[model samples]
Target: MREVVRAASLLIVLCSAFISSALAAGRILPHAPQIAFVSAFNNSANLYLLDIRHGALRPLTQLPSLQRGPVWSNDGLRLVYESNAGNNNINLFMIDVRGGPSAERQLTYFSFDEVEALFMPNRGQTPEGFVFTTVRGPNGDIFMLDVPPVGENNRPEL
Candidate 1:
């Protein structure tokens, strides 16, 4: 009975922490009324969209990897986030919110972790893409990746 009680207590504490963190990390889209967030309610952390007015919840990602730092594009048509999908190192990925899971595209392929991604505003003399930090050494390096144009074959340029 004591062991059961301890386990339940620990679960409650963990669940509370998770909920708090998720709520704190929620980001509202710039051009839309929906908010993007990460949640582990389905056992694995994945991106989700919450309709602010209607209170509708939609899961954006269903992969068995941890997704974090969801940032909306300038136009709010897409989202960029970090995910540890293929390996232990986290990489940046972009997905069209309306395109569903199939629209997800891996942005960085480095062995080190890339995180804290955000889309750059389209302005004079500024390229269109997102900026992210790469954890390579003692200090994290910031990089700006240009958005690749989709080729005629319907694939992103490498």
Candidate 2:
């Protein structure tokens, strides 16, 4: 009976260890997805992900310039931010928070110089999307960048 009890305790311990390791391995850079507001306008403002698993900071943009005024996607899977670099163009860019390569391949082009961006959900049968604000003289106008749903299995779809 003592041997049997010892064997059961050993089995439980091994199972617990295996479960812990499995959970650890499954945790990638982000155990939970995060988006941050950065100071890229003057002091190297860029979006950063607080990777809980790696315990490190990850920048969303690959650009060598400054970025700011980030707007996260409706589903919280992606972000679109503004970058100026003291140039005439203030381009919009999108990146994934999960820290892999950005699924969308192109940077959004705006004819007007942009200053900030935001995303609003279409909660009442409106099909959610995003909005961006760009400076036109002293006034800034907010515009929409409509996008299709990620579709089907929707694992935190963005």
Candidate 3:
């Protein structure tokens, strides 16, 4: 039964190819999530992601301005931080880790200085927005802004 043997071998080869392609396409399994952080690099501060499993570091933000106080969302999908890029005051910004550096969005349009921002999780433990201290005139007050989660098409409203 040489024909029967050849047919079985061909079937096995096609199955193996399909399985290999599916795995390589990232459809069968996905990469583990990583942690994001901010650090000084090349004389300027920027954001970086740390792959804790393999100790690999990936640069997420490569701006010339100072990026600091990065706080990850409750779901670990986005980051909110303060940046002084092209502004006289430090303002809050949000960036998606999956969308790369161009995905950075300015959340605050005011001239006030915002600092120490952090994501506040809701009762269900999902990130609602961020709370930070802003300096208005001679006093600093804590402010909150509710924003849509990252990757959504909606723009954040103050």
**Stretches of model 3 off by over 4 angstroms after superposition:** 1-33, 100-102, 125-127, 149-158
Model 1, 47-79: lDDT tens digits are 888765455678888898889899888778788
- Model 2, span 1-158: residue lDDT tens: 67445544544553465453231101112224332545232335455554433335565654557666666666567766677644658867666666654343334555567655666765865556577667777888777765545432222211
lDDT of 3 by residue, 17-94 (tens): 545323110111023435455555466777777554454557777899988777776656667888998887998888
Error of 2 at 83 (Å): 1.4
Best model per lDDT: 1
Clashing pairs in 3: none
After TM-score superposition, the amount by which residue 133's alpha carbon in candidate 2 deviates from its true location, in angstroms, is 1.9
- Stronger candidate by TM-score (1 vs 3): 1
TM-score of each: 0.76, 0.56, 0.68
Model 1: weakest 10-residue lDDT segment is: 149-158
10 residues in a row with least lDDT, candidate 3: 21-30
Badly placed stretches (over 4 Å) of model 2 are: 1-35, 39-43, 52-54, 85-87, 104-107, 124-127, 148-158
